[model samples]
Target: MRMKIAAAAAMALTAMPLSASADGEVNIYSYRQAYLLEPLLNAFEKETGIETNVVFAKQGLAERLEREGRNSPADVVMTVDISRVNELVERDLVAGVKTDTLTGNIPENLHHPEGKWYALTTRGRLIYVSKERVEEGEITTYEQLADDKWNDRICTRSGKHPYNIALISSMIAHHGEAETEEWLRGLKDNLARKPQGGDRDQIKAIAEGVCDVAIGNSYYYGNMLMDENQRPAAEKVNLIFPNADGRGTHVNISSISLTKSAPNRDEAIALMEFLTSPEAQRIYAEANTEYPANPGVKPTGLVAEWGEIHPDDLSLQEIANHREAAVKLVDRVDYDG
Candidate 1:
């Protein structure tokens, strides 16, 4: 499995490097996998007669663009996680863009205030509890993760991973840094094992009796259910949209940005607007099993079956602002150790 993933990453990287492009073409450097973005790109090309060229990599596109400077051929940068998109903006690899359509389609909190990036899709940070062990209504809030009764029953991925950091950042946003730090310490004490593995592994752990509950993103439940071998393990757990009754569920986005060096700025903007359109947003949600950034669009497939998500009203930019403090709290708790 590791070899296959490595080979896939290698093949994705070997795709042609972006270069100065023709009039009707837009070049993209994406951390998002090809399968995830191709449907949207294909639809854009078919509708507008503009070509889309892509070079995919899991990391380092920001540094590469920094090195290439003004000569970089990337017109758009696409990636998952706000931290990554924020990194591009911080490095000055992305340029702020504004359009009436874009501004109208995305919520204020979901996009950068300066328009440097826009969220394409979102997913909730939810809890999954073993169906056999945890009863309905037994747990309902992020604050409960730290409750003493749950000691030795909780599981999580590394606290340093962007997903957890984002969740922790939200904690910092709602509670002050000091209170969040205390919560982290208590949450750490509840762990079934030292924080390890991806979200899916946590679900798998619940099935194996390694733990009774786990924290993970909502879409991963869809992914696990889609796999034949993973479905049983997925069925062993039930999802809880934490904090639904209070601040609403914490959510994170997969984002897109306009590059500072865009040579095909017009065409790139066209594609960007196309992605925000209801039609393309629906297609994206259907293909990825994630919530559309455009509220007018509805999710399909298993994600739709999971039910409507009430996203936390807190500003994501503010949450991003607290990320550094969140990381410090994680270290202070020795969360992964």
Candidate 2:
């Protein structure tokens, strides 16, 4: 069923090969980091002789799409979070794509329900704790962070961070606002230092004994443990996947879609199909130190080394389904307030 969908999508949008120099030119508007996305783009260009041009930004890709509109030269819209995908959809800036390859590749949870966006890779939102301070097997759940026991021993990135927002949203998905609020209030009281810096900084603070535990997406840990500045933080911290009892770990995706008015619609579809194939998926995962959306693909070595985790099966639609409510709850709780 999945494979058939991808093939149909591939054929559906492709037109005359637009006789370019086969430079494999693909114009991508991405929110994913340039360093993480570049390796994959380079590899694709090398294999297909296509030139990959990227415009990387933290926000406002939608505005760019809107500005360009029907005359937009963009061939692909690639970025993170379900909210971003939904934004593209709401703007009518994305087109539906079907490819048996994509279907067989990405899980239904990671991809758009209506075939508009396909999750290319995923990151787990989990806990990071100080090895020297946090005893092994002491904390096992996200709710534990809200426990009074760890008060003043926890460090976190800013609540305003999207990752944190999505995490709070996930809690709403499972436990509702009132219950989540109680947890939030507890966590707020427990703040080690007012949620300063990025995920890496939280782990670093733990190493510095500023906190005993922290919450972060998995890749920061992967990067910290690998390429980032090393210290006790890199050495003394461990990662834990929480919420796996029934809801599974909170997982977020970096996905791709085609512009609704893409001038190079065929090129966009081709790029999308090529992306879901095994080769691109591998690069996508390895580069980002994330899990590939395809079930058949093993996580990159770093991820495999992180050990296996049961991810939340809730679809992008389901996770995204609660966005408005999640936003309201985040504001109501005054997470950053």
Candidate 3:
């Protein structure tokens, strides 16, 4: 239901510099690159008549947010992954909120169960199969990637990466640790290429005929298609939503939360609701090639073309909870295979 009242809601590589200041504005340390979010930021400023200043960084925002502490001027924190969001909560860096708009806009599992954070965008870590090489129904679920039919023909990014860890954690939530480990082992045995590069590289490999199937998040394909530069890589393979028969495919989020000592508490909460509102949800989902977290807001062109999927109903916290087990399993099994 689109609430008539209102609603809710890095840098590791590009690690861009943080913006020192922007007069009469919230300082945003965003993990998304400058171009990816420029349109929305520009739109936010135009609509509200408030200049929105954002600094792009990956590894250092959490530390920086922590260091700024009581004196920090950040009105809102925007970043990726549940573990990192939980880190802000764990550090008491985020504030709990209760807004009718948010409560109605986002589902329970997508946000912080306590409202410390709210999801803005979603990306499924789904299976990607080469259209020409594989039978259409041969691979439908993530579990099928481990089948002997795929032996020595899989390609993926390293499991140590947070995206893969989150995916494995979702698997743990769905299947328990033992079954999850066995699946990782099976997934490992089928690698055609050593785990390397970003999701786009994995998709590009499929385009190059390096593997029969690849597992990656959804936005990589979206960004590729959106960016004139990456068009060739974007067209190589087709997306496959996995595990539809069981728990559904694992999904991840890019979300935001208010800083604990926000100078502009009202502004922060207002921004949260603004981001999750149907209008903003539509913009983020369409422009960024991510699924909108607000159930009422249908994804625009990019995601619509990819097809609808049922997000694994498991809580985001459960995925973060099982991160340790996932890492241990990946290491023990040499997931780099």
Clashing pairs in 1: none
lDDT of 1: 0.87
Regions more than 4 Å wrong, model 1 = 1-16
lDDT string, candidate 2, 1-337, tens digits? 0001111122222331222233336667777656677667666666666566556667777886787677666668888877787788878898888778778788777788778899888899989887777787788788888898997888887776777777877787888878988888888888878767888888788888898889988987887777656644677888888866767898888889987766656666777877888888898888778888888888868899989988988776776766777777767767666
- TM agreement with the true structure for every prediction: 0.95, 0.88, 0.90
Per-candidate count of clashing residue pairs (backbone under 3 Å): 0, 14, 6
How many residue pairs of model 3 clash at the backbone? 6
Ranking, TM-score, top scorer first: 1, 3, 2
TM-score of candidate 2 on Cα atoms, chains taken together: 0.88
Candidate 1, residues 1-337, lDDT tens digits: the string is: 0001111253444354655856788888888777677788888988998888777677877887898889888888888887788778778889999999999999999899999999989999999999999999999999999999999999999999989999999999999999998899989999999999999999999999999989999889888998999999999999999988888999999888999999999998998899999999999877777899998888888888888888998888889888788889999889999
The Cα error of candidate 1 at residue 32, in Å, is: 1.1
lDDT of each: 0.87, 0.76, 0.79
RMSD of each: 3.5, 7.0, 5.4
By lDDT rank, best first, the candidates go 1, 3, 2
Task: Name the better of 2 and 3 by TM-score.
Answer: 3
Which digits, one per residue and each the tens of the lDDT, describe model 3 over residues 18-133? 23344345556566665666666666666666556566666666777777777776767887777678778777888889789998999999988788889999989988888788
